[model samples]
Target: MDQRNALLGEQFGICPICLKPDPEHVDHDHETGKVRGVLCFSCNAALGQFRDRPDVMRRAAAYVEGNVWKPKLVAPGVYRLPS
Candidate 1:
């Protein structure tokens, strides 16, 4: 089996982050090309959006938990920005 398939088998074909089944993405270290594990599209996308930076992710988590401000949806396509 391919490395991705093998890792998926080890992870029970589920996303290690969200624990969703049929995880088709192979999460890896872009710099080192190391195999991390399998992840679903959403989780992988989130990581990519964060530039695979643990510091950024941690700061985001802290921001959410800190609750500095909460933005509200004002309309169907509009929302208020945090101050």
Candidate 2:
């Protein structure tokens, strides 16, 4: 079988990130150009928007889950989120 078809079959036609079916786009690491997996269009676009930064993605996920950071005033015009 073709490698792409094999991969799609391995994923059961679902986007690994969003668990949506019929993921037609191939996702890869921009830095190394290595194939990561298949992803739906929206998820693939979202990764691009996030610049493939895992930290930023985690924060975004946290924000979406209502874990918004409450910045503490440290100094004049300086606010910091608790670590």
Candidate 3:
């Protein structure tokens, strides 16, 4: 039928990001204004708070996974993280 119905069917009515059911929000690319997938309220809000930055999201995921990077003092009051 419609786009929303199609998306829900495609995702099986679950939030793809969190794998939770009854997702109510349609997630989209802000810059491109393209529909990505259906997401639950929390997942949608999290993406909004992250400002849709994939790099930042990746770092956040890493931090959550306990792969934290400690900053090193390179100079006076200057901290740098190893790349």
Candidate 4:
């Protein structure tokens, strides 16, 4: 088994997400909530894409809604995307 995975198995006792005897690492975002998982890399990515910033995700949901958004970017000195 992988070193980190084994360490997780020995230390954490179970993967945080799977709740299985699988190994896991503690993950967290500097600007977000508790690091939520003891699963593999793929699961973490899925959670990030799904749960983080749901409003922005809703805006992205436009294509699924069959709506169109104009690309009107005002004087760009550097701006954040709408949420």
Candidate 5:
């Protein structure tokens, strides 16, 4: 057992995704008491990219779901300049 693992509860320390005996790297949202998930180092870093901003993250999700994103552009991309 990892030294940090002792911090989080025993059985609770297991990561649900990989079901690995993850160390004490439990991540939670600062704004919300939302239990994100138990993750290993890689997944934890990935989650950090979201920064716990559900609204912003949701918008990104909507963009993906609504087909607002484009893939494989050969030429330089053009973006709207903010006014």
Candidate 6:
């Protein structure tokens, strides 16, 4: 097997982060163009969503950890906080 496929097998065809089986996408460094590892589509999308910034990712984690928003029930199937 080639290097990419080999890495995919090593990772068991699943995303290391979310541990979900998905078509493999190679993850790499945008700056230096260095190959990092293989990841699933969703996990790869997450890095893009975070703009590949560790600081932004950390802030998002902190926000989730803070749990600043609590769900409020509005209707049978609708739930939202009042503005």
For lDDT, the strongest prediction is: 3
Q: Decide which is better by TM-score, 2 or 5.
A: 2
On residues 2-83, what C-alpha lDDT tens digit does candidate 2 reach at each position? 7777899999989998899999888899999998888899999999999999989999999999999888988999998656
lDDT of 5 by residue, 1-83 (tens): 35345544544767654567754466667678675554677657656787866666666777878845445545689554321
- What's the TM-score of each model vs. the native? 0.71, 0.88, 0.88, 0.32, 0.38, 0.67
State residue 24's C-alpha deviation in candidate 6, in Å. 1.5
Model 6: runs farther than 4 Å from truth?
67-83
lDDT of 6 at 24: 77
Tens-digit lDDT track of model 6 for 1-83: 38988887888887788888754789988988887778888888999899789977776786789845567878997889523
| Tens-place lDDT digits, model 1, residues 1-83 | 49888999899888988899999888888889887998999999999899899977876887889855466889997988754
Candidate 3 per-residue lDDT, tens place, 1-83, comes to 38987998999989999999989898999999999988999999999999999888999999999999898998999999657
RMSD of 5: 7.7
lDDT of 4 by residue, 1-83 (tens): 46555557554766565555654445566376554445556546645776666565677678679775656566676544544
Candidate 3, run of 10 with poorest lDDT:
1-10
Q: Which residue pairs overlap in candidate 3's backbone?
A: none
- Model 4 scores a TM of 0.32
Clashing pairs in 6: none
Shift in Å, residue 77, candidate 1: 34
Q: Give the whole-model CA lDDT for all candidates, comma-separated.
A: 0.85, 0.90, 0.92, 0.58, 0.60, 0.80
C-alpha lDDT of residue 36 in model 1: 90
lDDT of 6: 0.80
Assess candidate 6 and give its TM-score to the true structure: 0.67
Lowest lDDT sum, 10 consecutive residues, model 2, at 1-10
Q: Rank the candidates by lDDT, best first.
A: 3, 2, 1, 6, 5, 4
